[model samples]
Target chain A: MSENIKNWLLFILTVAVVILLSYLANSIINRKAESQFAYTPQIEIGAHEPRNVVWGKNFPRQYESFMRTRDTSFATYLNGSKLRDALGEDPRLVVLWAGYGFSKDYNQPRGHAYAIEDIHNTLRTGGPTGPGTGPMPSTCWTCKSPDVPRTMAEKGIGEFYKGKWADKGSEVVNPIGCADCHNPETMSLQISRPALVEAYENMGKDIKDATHQEMRSLVCAQCHVEYYFDKNIAGQEGVPYLTFPWKYGTTVEDMEKYYDQMEFADWTHPLSKAPMLKAQHPGYELFTTGVHSQRGVSCADCHMPYQSEGGQKFTDHHIRSPLDNVANSCQVCHREESGALINDVFQRQKKIKQTQLSLEELLIRAHIEAQKAWQLGATEAQMKSILMDIRHAQWRWDYSVASHGGTFHSPVEASRIVSTATEIAQEARVKLARLLGQLGFSGEVAYPDISTKAKAQAFIGLDMDKLNDEKETFLKDLVPVWKKEAAEREAQMPIRPVSSRE
Target chain B: MRFSSLKKKLLPPPQWRRPVIILLGIGAGLAIYIAHIANVGSYLTDDPTACVNCHVMTPQFITWRHSSHREVATCNDCHVPQDNFIKKYFFKAKDGLYHSTIFTLRKEPQAIVMHEAGQEAVQSNCIRCHISQVTDPRTAAGVSNHAENRLDRTCWSCHRNVPHGRERSLSSVGFHLEPLPVATRKGSFVPAWLDAQVNHTSN
Candidate 1:
């Protein structure tokens, strides 16, 4: 070959090789990008698709891992996915929450998988055959199911919360799942509960503008946080509107101030005649004050870390206590030994428990003292301030204790809340003693004999037999119909297996 | 002049230099690859004997030794899954590559987060062996499976607080002191030394 021809041929050959290598690299990169975003609609996911198995066909990894919430073996010091009967374990709770539905039956929360089953089994829902008749309002099912969003979408949000708990039993069959916190089209974490969005609007904040990192914990916050059904909300009256008291703030004092200003009380205390307030679980709120949260650690960071399977990674949706997986949870943030980290949790828990027990005793005594004052013909005017103190005090106490995992989860904040409650309760008792003296009785009123759970239940006048009978009747008559209807409806839905191209 | 002559001889002509350099480079790469495959690098799995490795798992190892689950299980038994042959193998390979890379780069995170999926994998294995076995319907077990009543709660549902049953009971063989005391240097070795002394004295 001529020298010039040889040079030109070599140049052409080099350019061809370069082009081939670049094309190969680009193809590999594109395939990888495709793998991450390779979602194809294998089965039609309806708007009301509540069954996770159906969703699993389209998103196998998330679905398979979400099913793991059914595993109940994992236990921690204070919280886990396992079923624990709080009343059976500590019956003092029954008396403390006398004249309330929770006193009838209360259990430590299990995984989200059992939300529907646990609610069905609970005695609080009571027996009802007709609309607007059950013991619990339709708002009770708001946090328990993905069916909630579907119903809220079908019926207007206000209309959905307008009926009784049993009115929509069949309609709300699916437990909390992917739909509750995820948008099917995007698979992005989205708030499905209207209550959360409305609460944000009330505070002049837009939840849509939340950061991606915030969404990790915000998904669980949809259900786990405290809320109350406001019956007197203007223009929304009689709707039993689910509202968060975050207008003022989320702190115990802030919520108490808001309730006090509105002269709101959950119920007149059966024993003390004090205006009482019930504190729902404030897990997310208390969690935010912890060192972990301050360091930008989210609920999902510890509770739902990422897992790898078949060379692909996805978020694990088995949300529960982190202690069960310390290596994955705390060890990721703190280099402490697993045993040492567990001990850290236990130590905080034990110290807080000591004060919490003390606060409970003091509050119990305060209730009895207030009752004695009322018994002595103390005027309502005279008891008003004491009642308010009792109200605020017990609210604080309940806020700390009822916020499951609060002590170990946020020990410092939990301790402060309990201490403040103890102070207010002690002040209430002091006023009660003076009121009793003015009524011509001075010595300490003999405390009720509530050493055991049975004694406490009797003390509180809870007809357990009658309650259990009603529950049995409801389960026998109503639950079966709900389940049958749900099964019939689900069976009619479409489910298609993956097509074989081979 | 001698040095210049030596440099010229070592350098070789331009054409010869390229071939020589390429051949030497390929030979060096093959030798290193063989060495790596043969595990000839000073890679230390046990850092106690090889201080240069500085194993990052001492705390975990100690905690595992003291754990109640330690006797019945190992670290891998609870943390790794036994399902999906492909996935299991992938996990081992990925973890191996990751550890190797991190060791090479010296940039591993101080604390590793074990994913919820990993814990679930462990949990499945736990439930597999510990399935409920009480066949009799009459007994009032912690979790009874009464066919007549249709009340069949799982074993862990009620017995959730019983994992450290032996430690709580304290009557078992391996009951250590509560709120474990810091081991003194003398205290730790006293048992070993006493055993040796007793053997020597007896001999």
Candidate 2:
């Protein structure tokens, strides 16, 4: 009714409206921040904190989920976290790797959680009491643990590599975790391995300048790429320094050229007497050629999709074969039916296996022929070209096979590598025949009887009894010591819990 | 004359004015509330149901039902979120909203891109649950080492087939036969007799 009353009411109404709007906006902003910063540091995470539980106090979801890599139930068509004895299914491998430790025991890879256990259980790393006593170098544990980076930092990189695997067993206990790839302060992906950084450096590139999209796959490349130990680095002598043979390039041909230039050989073939190169798993390199990668799909895109629970969301920490979860891994990118996507993977694998097996048979024959030539007193000059051919052929074969999941990861490239291997092997056999004929021997070189794994071992002249006996002795005698030492060391590490009220 | 003129000049307000104002207020409130609810709902159901929403995933769902991890895990259990709650939630909210919106619109991603981050997430969850009970010392160690080095190495490095075994058919697990045992239209189980008959006839 009065002018003053009307003005007072309007002022109050305006204030109420402004207050409500501000509260709503603030709520929205707070929720966004909470989702990103829910994990407050309960206790200060040391730079070298190897244990994930320590990190768990601050980030429970990640730590709890990261711990799940131990599940062995999910299996895919081509890849999963379960261990399968590959040599048992195909005994031809024993003959192929006759002089190598792999022929003794080789199982399909499992989840990252089993990295430490698998290495310890393998007979390849012989039992030893101290440094330099075991068959395997300390570099063997490099890819298995985050403790590796911590150890490398404490002891200079070269010094860490200058010993046997058994010497560091007590120190490297934790499995792969966050510290391996993420910057603790920013939670952004970071390269922790020096080898990857150094490899980039050799190419005149800076890792810090890598694009964000590249970091997704680059993180996996930290461990999954092909690598070898270079004991001849100028100042790194006497140390089996881990290195990627990427000086020439990242392609199969590039790596082959680099290895050839260095005259690098993993081991001399027992039967063929050829200098050989072993291709470590090159999952990243092969994946780069896949349709998905071509489409700019990072490994993190399909394998680590987002998840929600209890009004909160988080990244699922489980990593295994993509076939295990096609809907999440492939369906996100491919419109094809689940069956169709799986069929695509299987088809690629089947086709690749066809060529791979053919190459294997050819390689077996080549090795036998080379041995026969050497037995006939062939000179190094006479066997030179044949040996080189054998080396190149096996390298190609190993490149395709050792790049685990390469068929599904990059079917076209895998097929090409296998075809190349078949051609090289065939050429080697032709050369071997000529050399044998010149030595006054003729006709086909009789293939060895390697129908069974046991028969193959006998053919290789491996004292199975002695080897097995030694493996058993090492496990029984040395494994317990490593465990005890590890327990004591872990006990010494400080673990401060967060104050609940805080 | 004056009282009669005043009464005639006074007119009642139109009946629709007050009702119209009330109706407009209610309609505006309903529109705003609906928009808010829709935004929140989109994030929850987006990709969460994408795997099962499609008919193609039906058979796989059946297999997943019989899977050992069925009780404790879901599709997301093995596929998304490699590590960290903050990162996980950010991803889920962002991707969930995107997927939910796209899936709701009946659009799915073409050419699935395998994410190492997603695989690492699934692998981490697997080791967390199963590592302690692992009987094999070597396997246990590998599991431990992998967990510690989660950023560098994946769990699939050693435990290659823990989830689904190899790609081979169940028959490849030693159940060899000419064909999978099937039920006839008469609801009778196909026996070894039928299997042999089919094989012999084909040969």
TM-scores of the candidates are 0.66, 0.66
Looking at model 1, residue A489 earns an lDDT score of: 87
What RMSD value applies to candidate 1?
20.2
Q: State the lDDT of candidate 2 residue by residue for A1-502, as single tens digits.
A: 8979986996698567656655544544454444233323566566667877777776676677677788888766555777877777677888888888877777878888888888877767765756558789889888888887778767767777888887887888888887776555445566667677677767666556665557768888989999998887777777788888776778889989989888899999999899988888888888898887898777877666534333233456777677777776788558999998888888889888988988999999999999999999999998888889989998889888887788888889889888988998999999888888998899898888888778887888778787677778877887778779888988898876434334
In terms of lDDT, the poorest run of 10 residues in model 1 chain A is A31-40
What DockQ class does candidate 2 belong to?
Answer: incorrect
TM-score of chain B of each: 0.40, 0.40
Question: What ranges in model 2 sit over 4 Å off?
Answer: A1-41, A498-502, B1-203
Evaluated against the true structure, the overall lDDT of model 1 is 0.69
Which portions of model 1 show Cα errors greater than 4 Å? A1-41, A496-502, B1-203
Q: Residue-wise lDDT of candidate 1 within A1-502, one digit each (tens)? A: 8979986996698567656545544543444343232333466566557887788777776777788889899777666777887777767677678888887888888888888988988888877765567789989999998888777776667778887898898989888887887655445566777666666666676665666567777777777788888888666678777777777777888788878787777778888888888999988889988888887777888888754454233466777677877876788668999999889888998899888878888888888888888888989899999988888888998999899888976889999999999999999988988899899998978877877667778888988788788888888888889999989987987775434222
Q: Candidate 1, residues B66-97: lDDT per residue as tens digits?
A: 33354366555554556766776566556555
Residue A415's lDDT within candidate 1 is 95
- Candidate 2 reaches a DockQ of 0.01
